[model samples]
Target: MNLLKSLLIVVIGILPFVVNAQSNNYKVRKCFGYQRDSCTTSANIFYKLNEDSRSALFVKGQSSQTIVSIYNGRDYRISLCWDHILGNRMGFKILDRETKNVLYDNSTDEFATDFEFTVTQSRDIIVELSIPGESTLSKSEGNEELIIIRKDKEMGCVGVLIEHMITPTKGF
Candidate 1:
């Protein structure tokens, strides 16, 4: 009986950690492919969705990059979407992977969330995305309790939608 009681106590002690881990996994699963359908709908008729289109959990003030191949003779549209908690004006840029040149920067276009352009030459490009705001756990905040609460509330989903279609040939 004493052994059983000890086992029960141990299980009770470990329950919270198990539950917390499950909840974290659930949050990530909920964000996965979040914008796949909604973002692609805008390009459905003219463009086919590229496999590289994806969504991920993001926190304010975080930045990430993904590389994608752009084929020559194709027109592509790139769109960005996020949970409103992350706010608007998220930064988006396209850089040439080999030359590292900034091919395009949304900042100059009033932080446009979507861009469409034709690829003249096949190449790999880096798409960089940045969420707006200061880090959620900034040391300046100092309040541990507030930091914990803010971290949960500030996390959100960010999606990049890439669509492509053959560049239409000029008039015959």
Candidate 2:
């Protein structure tokens, strides 16, 4: 009985470590073919939206803020994708890092899945990703509910894909 109890305790202690190892391995798998890519069908659609840009991945419920340089007179397509298990709850926002002015907010825009815009000036912009709390958000400042989704202790992956739009030249 004593030996059986000891073995059971040992297995239970090591179970978490084993599970964590498997999850870590899954995260680093070549399933996406790249670190910034996604393996889901929905994500594949976004990947085809633009060819000049690549995608970046993050864990669900965790916020990611990135500073990117936007060139003047250039159009960019920014898309967001989650594990698909999380549904359409994933959203992102673009803000002028210096002025804190919101360049784009998906939540207010009917939970838009993507955005396309042309910048007039070259500047550093902040891209933020979050799991929205409310099903719908209105255009009111300081009254939005910012909720994080905790689907599981080991949350799945989310991706942000940015593609630069090619402008047609005047040459004929």
Candidate 3:
């Protein structure tokens, strides 16, 4: 019994370090922040959204702030799951390059759904998501990255740890 207890204690002590390990992604351009042993995802990921910049839109009022910059004719999807129910609020400012007009600006509100967007130009872009300091964010800001760029009194408090940017290699 004594020997068994000693082994168990050692395993428990090393578990935290074993868990809070480095993460990697093939498409992760920049890893700005990180945290471990917090949420179900195990690790939070932040990547630079620079691939497609022309067609940019900020994903406002989301559990995870999803900022995506994609070129013309590319399909992208972002999925964010929280420990608790997330407030459904997201807005988009889709720009029309040729006319240089605000084509579609809609606030996306849903209980929990996979947000999707398509870029229409090969230009630089910006997308942002915001989450309220509610239930889902009960734990510490384990690992988060808030983009320094703020527009028109916009304060960023979105703790979106994981993000994925999808780009189309061929076909213009």
Candidate 4:
């Protein structure tokens, strides 16, 4: 009877840890491939997906970046997709990796989420994504010491879909 009780105690003690671990894993797995699988299907008809396309969990006011090689003789399209909680006008920028010159900024184009351009020269470039909003903390009941946690502050998936194809020859 005592051994059974001890085993019961052990199971109870381990239960919370196992549950917490699974929840965390679920959060991560949930975000994986979110953008590519859900958002980019329409584009697949025209452009082949580049291997660097990816998705990740993002919080408001967070920024993330990735580098990819843009080869000459190809036309490329970059599209951004995110959970509505992350807002509609997320910022996206493409910069020359070595020179740090801004090649493209979505803000200039009315914050358009999709961009298409033909590469004239092969180069490595940086693709930067930014989510807009304040941090998760907020004042509660006009008290600075008290905090109000918001469910909307939860992380959401952001996807950068990169697709490309050979630039078609022009003029017969």
Residues 10-112, model 2: lDDT tens digits: 9999999896554346556522533244522223332234332334434434466877877786777776665544455766789999999998888899887
* Worst 10 contiguous positions by lDDT, candidate 4: 134-143
- Winning model by lDDT: 1
Q: Looking at model 2, how many pairs of residues clash?
A: 0
Residue-level error in angstroms, candidate 2, position 155: 0.7
Q: Which pairs clash inside model 2?
A: none
Give the residue spans of candidate 1 off by over 4 A. 1-28, 137-151
**Tens-place lDDT digits, model 1, residues 111-162:** 9999999999999999999888866453344654655436456777788988
TM-scores for all predictions: 0.75, 0.57, 0.35, 0.74
Off by over 4 Å in 3: 1-10, 13-68, 81-107, 111-113, 134-172
Task: For model 1, state the Cα shift of residue 109 in Å.
Answer: 1.1
lDDT of 3 by residue, 85-169 (tens): 2233433344544454654444534423334555566653333334443322233264684444232122222222233344446
Q: How close is candidate 4 to the true structure, as a TM-score?
A: 0.74
In candidate 2, where is summed lDDT lowest over 10 consecutive residues? Answer: 132-141
**Can you write out model 4's per-residue Cα lDDT over 1-172, one digit (the tens) per residue?**
9999999999999999986444246456766776666565443476888898888878777788899999999999988888877787899999999999999999999999889999999999999998898555421234557544444455677888888998989999
Any idea what lDDT model 3 has?
Answer: 0.38
